[model samples]
Each structure stands twice: as C-alpha cells, then as structure tokens.
Target: MDSPNVLLLLTTLSLTVSSAISGSVVEDLANLQPPSDFNTTIMKNCQHNPSLRYCNSSSVDLKEIFRFTIVASHLCNESKNPNCVHSFDKIDLRNRPKIAPLYLSYSFFWKYCPSTIFSIDLSNTSLKGSFPTEVLCCAQIQALDLSLNGLAGEFPIESFSPLTNLTSLNLSYNYFSESKISDSRFFKRFNASSFIHSGLISYQECFKESTSLTPSMLRAATNGFSRKNQIVRSEGVEIYKGTLRDGTEVRIEVYRDCISREKRQEFVEECKVLVELRHKNLVQVLGWCSNRNKRAIVTEWTDGETIEMWLSDSAPPWKLRLKILSGVVAGMLYLQENWPEVVSDIRIDSVLLTDNHEPLLSRFQVGDRYRNSKKIHWFGIFLLEIITNRRSQEFERGEAGFIEHVRENYPENLHEVIDARMKLPENIFDQAKHGIELGLMCTDQSISKHPGLDQISHMINKVYESCLELAPQNHKRSHGDGEEQQDDQSKQQKTTPERSETGDTVYNITCSSQWIESAPVVLKMTSSRY
Candidate 1:
C-alpha cells in the first residue's frame, strides 16, 4: 500500500513539471512577437471589460500620471485641485498598446462614465458606420472630432440640438452630402469647409464665377483699392486685404491690364482646378468677380504671414518646423495626385503660415504635366531652405550652391545646418538629419529618380514620429532656458514671389470650355549634378 501511494505522488509531480515547461514555452513565444501583433491579440481576447480600461495604478508605467480621480475630475471640468495638478511629469510609454477598431462606441462611455467624458477624438480611425448619436448623453462633452472616417448616410440633424454645450464639432471627410439640418442655426456654428465635398452644398454654390459683386463692392471692401489695402503687388496681380460688409475677411486679387486672352483662358482653367481642390493646407478660393474693366478672385484671409516672413521674424522650435514642413508635404501630395497639371511653380513663397503656425499653399498655377524635374528640384530647394533658413535666390550665385552647401557643410551633423534661432535637443538631431536627406532625395535631377509623393509622405511621417518621441526634458531653448522658448507673436505680411521670365507668377482664375491649349515652359536640372 505504501509503495502504491509513493508511485501516485511521483506521477503527479512529473505531470506538474511538464505543465510548467509548456507554460514557459508559450510565454517565450509571446515575447518574440512584435508589439503591434501582441497588442492586436490582447485587444482580440481582452479578459477585462473590452470596451474600457483604466490604467493599472500599481504599475510604475504610469507613476508620474496623477491618480485617476484627479485626471477624471479635470476631464470632467470640475474645479482645479492641488492634488490633481503637477508642475512636472515623467511618464513615457514609448511602446504602448494599440486598441483595435480604433474607436469606442459613444454608448460605451455613456454606460460607464457619462459625466466623466469631456472630449472624444477619433479622426482618421478607419471607422465605418453611422454617426454615434449616443454621444449626446455625455452632457459635459466639449470637443468632438469624427473626421476622416468611412461613416456614411445622413446625420440626424435634430440629434445635435442636445449638444448645445459642444464647443468644437468636426465632421469633415465623411459621406453626408444628402444630410440636412432642419435648423440653419446649427450651420451657423461651423464654417463652409466642414460641408465641402460632403455634397451638402451644391457645386454651383461652391464655384460660381462673378461673386454677384459689382466693382463698387470690391472698391468699397478694399477702401477704393487704396495702396493701404494692397497687401501684395506682384508683376501680374495685386492682392488687396479687405473686409466685406458681412464682416468676412477677404483677399481680393486683381489681375494686371496686360493679361492676354490666352492667359485669361489659363486663369479659368486654374480656377476650375482650384474649385475642385479643397484641402485644409491650400488657400481656399471663395468666389470670383469678373467684369470688362476689372477681374478679381476672392480667397479667405489667411491669418498668418508667408513662411518666408515668419522664419525671418520668429525662430520656431525644430518640432514646430517639422510640423510646418509636414503640412507642406500634405499639400504637395494632394496637388501631385489630384491636379491635372504639374505644380511647377512650387516655391517657398507659395506657403502661407496661419496664426497657429499651420501652413497653407497659395498662388496655385497649372503648367505642363511633365515638368516633374523642375517641380522636384524646386521642392528639394524648398526643403533645403527650411533647413538652412536661406532664400532660394541666395543659393544661385555662390560656387557652392544650395545642394552642394548642404552636402559639404553639414555632412557629419546635419542639425548644425539648422537655423540658430530654433533650440532643440541633441536626441532629435537624427530626425532633423532625416528631413535633410529627404530634401536631397526630392532634388534628384533624374526626371524619374525622385521619390513619389507617397514615399515622401511616409518618410516625413517617420521624421515626425521621431521628433514627437523626444521627451520634453531633452529640449533646451535658445533664448531663455526652460519651457518659455516662444514669445514672439508679431504677425508678418504674405507675398508672392517676383515674376520670372518663364511665365506669369500669378495667373488669372476662370473656367473654360477647352481644358488644353498651350505648351508650358519647362525647367530641367540634373539631380546627379548636385
């Protein structure tokens, strides 16, 4: 009997040992998987409540973060508390989990934390469904962003009435053209751009030439076309800063009297192109007024100055500079893929900076389709200019031109090529160097050698990620040490570049029956020569 009991104990011990080994092997396999895959699996088989997750308070990963009560109270817009506020924090979860579906049903928050919800941002999340009306239950909701989703069908206009406290609502880039609001007052809260491309506004309402404006209205808005109102006076066009009787700020561009019939036709083509193109980065065309004696195009007033002017006055941090360049890249991607003609005249002056430092492209013109080399070369030069803070024209006369200068001068540490005004950390210098290398790639003289817009966008995005990863502790300002690096708030004026002999820098905007007409002048340069 004793021998049989001992045998049974030995057998059970052996089985327990085997189970332990198997468990170890499974954990090792999991560790080998990529973080994204691991997170995906976690999301698929979450043991806890799948709809919501509170941080593990005991975990050191979020030690610097205030306790949930504090964080939740602030998000809920309760009065500030000393325990909730902190002057410093050091939590950096570089490899955090990514949840699938990339969205939370509005009802989930309503059921779990209704009063706690203050903001919901799900832009570019690949969400596909009807808009979540359950969000109305979150009474304290201040900001809601559902842009860049696959959501279709008409929105229930009446549902928005309960969201009276909502300060910001962004529903752009969704399929809701057939959507209608019973109350015009709801429409009053948002800009026209929100409804653009959604088909809420008719095509005729978008690009109706002759803004129903007599010459008198233009003159009246521009103080009788006075010199004070003339913001930009280029060879082919004069831009006037004006305010309409309805309090809308506008930039009125009046073409020169010497505009030929062919150029007028070209302007129409450009306008047709511009009317169809609606992007946040492009300076949007509101309407145009055409008369026998005078022709004018109206654009929304860009609140900030041209990039050239802003760079001159303020030395924005390297991170902000990368953000500005990224915006320009987005504009470039849209122009390259969508426009019928090549953007051969893409120069630094074409970019405008808004009050919040957002970049906008202006002075759009359509040229030959095959001006790829010229376009790429100028884009490269533009990148170089951003890095070196030197004007494109300045690089022409020197023996070591822009391309040569970058290669020779900053070969070891490309961040050395950066403008002295921006004070960034050494850790993010790698990101700055990556941007410089990309600029060189853009300038590749081989007509077919340059990276496509998609590739360029990807590379820029990587650089942006790198910049974002640099911890706040790493940053050191050029002026006063610490957080108060930016204080310059002076606004600069925007302008178009001087006209070139090749073509009119500013062209007339109109729509014509014939799309094609003349051959465009092309500038060819070899990227290999650099």
Candidate 2:
C-alpha cells in the first residue's frame, strides 16, 4: 500500500483501538502492511504490554506512531538482540558498527516517548559531526553516553541546560572543541574524567591560582626585565616572554614611564573583565600586576605565529584558511555577545594561531558604548584580509577603499582579489567568491546595513560546508601545499622571535593606518575617542 493508504489504515486502526481493546486492531497495527517500515516486534510488545506509556493512549497520533515505529525498526536489530523490542525507555545500541552514521532524528523518541525515555547509550556507534541535539528533547533523560565516536564541533552546553534531570554524560574520546564549555554551570556537575582524551582544553588549571600577581613575581618570570627576554617594545609599553617556576609559559605586558593614572586604571579594569570571560579561541588572561610604579597584564603564551605572518610568509590552502576564519568569527561572536565593548580595534595581528593553526583573539579594547555595527565593519575588513591576503590599510591608497574595491570586482573579477598564494579548484573558488561577497556585506559603511556576527557566522559556515563537500579534491591539493607551507613555517619560526605585545597608544576615530606595521600589537582604543 502507498503512504496515504497506510496513513488511512493507521488512522482506522487507532480509532478502532480507542473504541475497544480488540485483538484485531492490535494485530492490524502490529502487522502494518507493505511499504510501511513498522517493527512487528515493537508493535506486538506494545499490544502485549499495555502498561507502556504510548500503548494505552485513547487517541494516538498516527504520524507520531509511524515515526516511533520507523525509529524502532531502524535501531532495533532483532538478530543482535531479540529483546530489543521489549524496551522503549532505555536505548542501548552500544558497539553497533552496522549502524554507522546513525541519524538520530528530532522526532525519534521525542514526540511519542519523551517522558518515558530515560537513558540512551549509543557509545561507539560511529556518530559524527556535532552533538545530536535531538537527544535534548527527552526532558526526562538521565544518562547519555555518546563516547568513542567521531562527533566534533563546539559542545553546545546551553542547549543541554533545560535537561536539569541529566545526571550522567560521557563525551570522552571525541573531537569536540572547547568553546564556552569551560564557563558553563553544567560542566561543574560532571567529573573531569568524563571529558578525558576529548579535544577540550581543561580550564580548571586556569583558575587554581589568584589572578593578582606581584611585580616581583612578574620580574622573576621574565628574568628581571632582561633585554634578551623582551619580545616587543614601543612607546610606553614593553612585552616579555616569561616562564614561571612551575614551567607555565606566559606573556607579560608592562606599562612604563609614559602611562597616565586613567590608562593604568583602564588596564586594571580590562584585566578584571577579561578574567571573567573564558572561551577557547580568546587568549586566556592568567593574571595581572598593578602597583605604584608598575602595571602589567599577563596572558597565556601561544606557540604559533600571528595571522599576519601566516598569510605573508606561506600560502595556506583554502580549507585551512576557512577553518582559521571560522575560528576568528567564533571568538569574535563570543566577545560580541558577552562583552560588546571588548570588540573594538580588531587587526590582523590581534589574531594569533596555535601549533595546530587554531586562531585565538589576543587583543581586546573595551569601549564606552555598544557599537556592534562598527565591530561588524571591522570584521568585514578582517574577512577581506583573510580572503585576499592584503592589509586593510593597503586599501587606503585606493580611491574607494577595500570594501568598494571588492564590491566593484565581486562576482566578475573576484579572482583578481583572492590571495594568489592559494590555487583553488572551481568548487573551492566559488566559496571564496561567496566569502568576498559576505565581507562586502559586512563592510557597508551604513551601520544599519551591517550584518550581525551571528548572521555572518551562519553565512561563513554555509560556505565552509560547501567547501567541505569537495574535501577529497581539496585535500589532495592541500596535502602537497601543506607540506611546503610547513617547511616554510619552520624556516620562518627560526628567524622570528615569539612575541605578544599590547599597545597603549589610543587611536582616534579617523586613524586608518595599520596599528603596528610589522610587529604583533594589541592596540587599545578608548571607546569615547573611537
């Protein structure tokens, strides 16, 4: 029978079952005829055990019943476990390699069995690409095990917040990134071992000691301000790479003679705000020192080079570049949502990379007013920089600026602006064009026209997905390029000194030059002046 006829049959059977508890109606639903993928064992179990939650409903939703039956049929392999149909409350399909890439649909158990389903164990089921948010619909779910799978993405802690009853969760042995999980209230409820071997960076170690450090401790870490230990030095500011007694590497920024009282206070205030905000992509601020003659901020040391150096020296593949840009957007979005003021003065150098090329936003400038539009505009420029491998200031020499330059060449001559270092195939090239257009949309001078970071994130992710479809092709090319780039990076790192510098010079609203021409500088801009 066709779908409509099957639905009609189900409706009739439901009506008949509601009228009277007859064996015929139960049998009809159990042996739901052709085309319908109903699990006979599950339907028979429901008929036998009327105590099951959905079994005794007066009037069943035929569609929901159909979905439930389909899910049961797909998940319950009778050959493996003859008793699989007997249970609806707990699903344990562990070590089921045949069910690879399982589609845990939203309505699987949610619509018909939300209240009844308590535990789910899909461990080692070969699940991939993000947490199955469908599981969140089960409000009464107590234990969930999604371990030993290929699931990777930002762990959505906020979505799990409603599941107050969720007691046990095992996300170990996955490729998940540590986004905002470090600061979530739910993380505290679980044991640290639950996330072991998972790609998540432990934030517990970050908060063990006090955030307030004395000048003597800072000096000891940096070898009493030795010249060779210094990373970057500019007017009124000096940065030094330090190693603590416990072997924790840190970057210390010291404000020297030219600092004002107001500037010193702003530094302290910024440190306090940064201490509260924790995201994997943002450089973690470890501690700070403020005394009569000394004022400084200390942040975790990253081994990789700045984004500027990454672009300038080597030709990274399109996929790698997109991944880095995506990370940058993630970090910026976190800052925008949490503290809009810290979203000021975004420069290419402000973004530092890790050994794995993960982008971390190292610079933060707190502004007085919330100007998301300006931040969006800045991000547009940043996006263009990644796509084109050109400095935002370089466009200043042009009559229309970088935004208009791209707008003029978009769709037709976009290839002219794309970084020549990358040799993109047609499919990947299309995504680069899409990225250019997105950057143009973001760089609109009119504040009302600017897209929010969330919207930008969606667009970028869409492009990233498109590129991912051509991964096999892109990977073949990027592999050779990656080897070459790695060799170049090795050479570059030897000659270049690892530096972490934050600038104290406040810029006015109209200053369009590069914050620091050659060095990595975290430029601070007073919001009022900006």
In model 2, the Cα lDDT at residue 494 comes to 23
User: Candidate 2, residues 1-530: lDDT per residue as tens digits?
Assistant: 22211231233333333334231122233444323434453365465545544566676654556545444433433112233334345666555554434435435345455354577777778888888877776667998888778889887778888888998777777898876565787776664435645676454643444278998899899999899899999998999999866566889998876467797787788877876555657887778998778888888888889889998988788777877877788888877777776753457787888865678888776665656676777787888889888785776654147667776765445556788668765445555655665566566443234556786676565555445434444333321132322233222322111122432222211111111232332222222211
Candidate 1 lDDT, tens digit per residue, 1-530? 22311121122322333244332122232222122233332333223323333222233222111122222322222111222222111111111113213113223323324233456655556666777565565546766766666677767777777677777666767776464442467666655555555545554543443244677888899999999888889987899999777566889988767566676666666665665667767887766666555678888887788888877878767767877877787887878877747363446676888864668888776666556556656677877788668775677755137677776644343445666566554444434544565566566443245655665566566556555544554434442233323222101111112244543332111111111121221222222221
TM-score of each: 0.64, 0.53
Candidate models: Cα lDDT each: 0.54, 0.62
Q: Candidate 1: what lDDT?
A: 0.54
> Per-residue error at 166 for model 2, in Å?
29
Residue-pair clashes per prediction, in order, are: 7, 0
Name the regions of candidate 2 deviating beyond 4 angstroms: 1-210, 258-263, 396-400, 471-530
Measured with C-alpha atoms, the lDDT of residue 479 in candidate 2 is 17
Q: Count backbone overlaps in model 2.
A: 0
In candidate 1, which residue ranges exceed 4 Å CA deviation? 1-122, 134-145, 162-170, 189-191, 199-214, 223-230, 233-236, 244-247, 342-345, 396-400, 413-416, 446-448, 472-530
Give the number of the best model, judged by TM-score. 1
